[model samples]
Target chain A: MRVENYSFVFAVFFANVFAWNPTPQVIEEQVPQTAFAQLLDFQNAARPEYNAYLSAGIIYLPLPSQSALLTEWGTHNGFAFRQRIGIWLTDNFDGKGSKGITFGLGWFGERQGWDNEDFLFVPNRGNFSQINQIHSWGLTIADSSKHWLFGGGLQYLNAKDESFRWWLLGTWSRFSIMPNFHKGDLQFINAQLFLQARELLGNENSWQNYLPDLEFSFYTKDSVKIFVSQNIFKQKYYLEGAFWARPQDFAYAALKFYPDPSRLLLALEATATKKDNDDIYFGGGITLPFLRVAYNHADDYESFFKSRGIWIVEIRLAIGSSGDSFFALKAPKAAPKEVKRIPMKKANFNSNNGE
Target chain B: MKSVKFLFLLLLGAFFSSCTHWLIDTETRIQVKNSTNRDIYELSVISPGKRIVLVPDTLKVDESSNVHVISWVGKFKFAIFVKNLPDSVYLGEYELKGGSIKAEIKGEDMALKMVLK
Candidate 1:
């Protein structure tokens, strides 16, 4: 099994590399000039755009804690490593009249180590080393006015755990509202809605319900952006606000900082509920070109802000071609082009046979 | 001893009332050998139950590729209507036929039946 899984990984890696390479066929088509220029424009606009990078990092709890008291069941603290690869599909359209769309897919897997000696407190006892895998796809569309951009799309997420299936719809627009607003070079608002399916597994009687999450990001400058996200799930509410800065644009990686291009990012999140398990998390991380690593601490306010001794570290990387266009370079000038249309056939075959 | 028995019964009742069941960790791995001169093509594993969905539905095989292996890690529960069960049940084995595969659980093992329609 291990050999097979590794072979599959190798196959996927080769396929991605093949896809990233700009063949002579592709180069002769003269695809990069306009796409590259558009990429630079989007970067300068201070909007959240997609880029390629490979990242592998580990998250450790560094503390022993459980939320059994707050909830009848909760996940335990552990350490896991995650690796993700992403690619871009489209680079540019034909100036303000050119419509462009970007799409990409990412796969991530994490393995958690467990203490085999621990007693069975949860329903699934003796199940050590939980392994979780997730696959995600995202799409973005925009019409560039050389100053304004707007579009939205849906992101589908499926994880090894059936309970993890969810969808997020996101819309964002960047426009210059006024000339005095820092040249309005990059002012954008984004909204995202996350939908979680209930009882996705076989548990038909579970109390779980769909959850909704929302977030907004605003780029105040070419180097700085502010965002606020609300995650409403598990009947609890979590609000987070963060400020991110990119001091160096020509770094070699996506999330990792170069020696001189490193910047400090700070985030504060508060989780509240009617129960006494409210928590506040303060985190800060350094952002580089290829990787981002951050340290977070959670404080339980109900416990008089007592330190939960919980720490979270997140590291993200980009693995593939830093810039590979996945979608059409130009958005349709008229109506959106339909990629696929399903035709209905063999209607009522079962009914016809029943007679 | 009497108190322990009473406690066990109470715990069992609580478990049943809460509709909570144990999560059984199951893992399956299958390897496809391309016996034909050409590649046997892609392979897919389908589950019989609506609650069961393959972690990955489509897998690609290269030309002359001898072995293509796929693995799934998850929990499986017996159907609610099944009664008088043995210690375990086996799910059937399946191979890609055209584009579909069939699977069933027979005890603790899954038996897969494959065809290329």
Candidate 2:
């Protein structure tokens, strides 16, 4: 039954993306990004300045951990989505940051038309499921405030197993605490939330907007990523790097060009695979206000990653209750106008209506 | 004459030592014991952030917070922020060789007595 609902969501998502509509991207402000949900909603992972956000995309890679591949069940390639919202107890404290708790919801699993690839590449998997029905959903919670942010997230799947990650960060330092970063770059406190959060939301819409005064960044599930981002060449481009001492970590040095801070972004990145030998994966992504498109490719289908290549499409949305509502990805609308008018009469009870 | 010369040298050394003590900063452990007429409402080891370590709960008179080891050179400042008293109190910069300082709160009027060892 759960899988059936998943199939329906997939259908609707495709229809919304591929089908033509009269609505244009300019009116996104009035529409509120989507009546749907997004990535941070912790993304305390949250660098965390938003009231809400939603991120969902399709990945071309399968789950590639020793445990994920050889455990009781092998995972499948499918669509991935992350959604989160901050229930602000006190919002935009001291004018820049907020105090709140963040709740997250997301899923990863089989796409309806896509073929089952769970056992196609595995060897000696006489016991593995050939039906290719692998799926996992995650729930996350974190304390999101200007002073501190921490998260504990768990993933549940059809297989009889669970993976849990605990994330904590102290935001006061305003820079990375760990030493393995490019000089003056920011560090990551929670990787799960911000690894993609920073990319999905961009610099202006980041949680940094809610910070009391300074900036910081993220790490990932297995490794840490240090980022140094600044607007250069008269604020036309942004550059950030993930520098690490160890070679077995996923690292990237990226540069992005944008005409406006929010409307469009083009990224050129040199991504590294965790495989021991020195090999770089180069890819780029193009971002619109609420949608992002990127291409993915493996290393000749022979290296640590499998399968040569595929394209990925993701939706990213972020909006906060405080600060400037105009930049909301469909942020909030302008405040209602005040009007004064003459008083009118009260209505009488109608026979057809029940009191 | 030799005894008189030694006494003069000793006096000169004493005066210079006291002057240097006033000039430099030092590191030491800090312990606060609530000895005031009223309990302590807030305690902080503030620097970049006004880190409030305690709240709502009272540090009643004669009860002390845990011993905080000050490992570096900075102002050993603190305060009690009750609603009626919005003003915070600061303990002046301290210089010590290699010991600890115990702050004894005497009253609600913010009379602080420091015992430096």
Candidate 3:
């Protein structure tokens, strides 16, 4: 099983790379060559550029609660660990306008760990005292235009160990409020709103009913990007801020040398809450093509705002698309003169699904 | 008039400072009744700002225990777990006050339920 899973992941990665390459092809005029050629002939046009993404990570939080931050330090601290994996496939049907459907599947599990500090303060057992697992599947339809972007989806979540399940309905919309600001390069400041609600199914029940997230993004020409978002989960509100930068011609040779300066990305983020009951997290991550690694530290009020010698590490692998266009690390160059097709709409060119 | 204003400001500051003590540690008594046929090796209560082990040893079937916890006065969501049990039960958000909170743990045909009163 493990070998099959590894082979599947590698195959998907190789296929994505092959599909994205803009290679020249020679077609025979007299005879049809193969089944693949026949399939291409049936479609007539070239294959649409689609994206597939897969991410997996492990989170450790000593203290566990509905309101507890997954990476926060101090309060209700316990040695608990949870692992999650998610996969998504999306493609656009209309050129220039990103009209597409996204299908996703996810699984998550938590493993309970024993408390080691019980002797310090009688009954001071660290938090990892519960086990919960979830499996989910989702489908979303999305459309993007010059002024508006919108999507909505229905997701099903089932508890692995209990008779609990729910259907979550979520919708999101983004609007480019103002015209692009040109300071040597063009940039746009955009705002987005996301909302989701859940309905309990069967006999089991849940506490949370709704979730909402609001965000604003600032994009410029291959320089820096700033994003701010406010999200609510489990009735607890959280605020996050991020800044990203990509420099030109930065490459590391894991094997052969590659000239994709845009493959390198550096990002810094902070996620916190207004209430002191939860810990705040500060972290940064770097992305290299198909891989990403991040580390974050949680500061807690219960521990006098100090790290309890704990760190959270997150790693992800994405197969479908490249990084955001704003972090391309190079300014746009003049289009090639021999243009056979009408230029793709600027709206699609500016859209960065990888962000 | 200036003296009166100064005195009022001082009194306001004192009141606000005293209110901060409202979150001082208080005793919370949790009563757990294991109404099952098998022994429970561990029973732990997991809350946002508090963690307390109600049963450190084996709690035999049909036994009850009153676990005393010291924490601030507020509502807490309890993530309760039993030893060797694959699943955990959640006692929805409840306020911690002077009275004893009761929870009955019962299972039938491999289905577990923790009813909080």
Q: Over the stretch A135-220, how does candidate 2's per-residue lDDT look in tens digits?
A: 32334343444424333332222222222222222322132121112223322342221221232222344544332211222333
Cα DockQ of the candidate 2 complex? 0.00
The superposed Cα distance between candidate 1 and the true structure at residue B41, in angstroms, equals 54
Please give the TM-score of chain B in predicted model 2: 0.47
lDDT at residue B13 of model 1 (Cα atoms): 55
B1-117 in candidate 3: lDDT tens per residue? 566557556644543232212232233466678886666644555645555555454567888875745332234454455556775555455444434567676774245556767
TM-score of each: 0.28, 0.34, 0.29
What ordering of candidates by lDDT runs from best to worst? Answer: 2, 3, 1
Please give, for residues A14-121, the per-residue lDDT of candidate 3 as tens digits: 332111110011111101111111111111111112223344544332221211222211223222233445544444321233434333232222222222121111
Task: Between candidates 2 and 3, name the one with more favorable lDDT.
Answer: 2
Predicted model with the maximum lDDT = 2
Pick by TM-score: 2 or 3, better one: 2
What DockQ does each listed candidate score? 0.01, 0.00, 0.02
Best by TM-score: 2
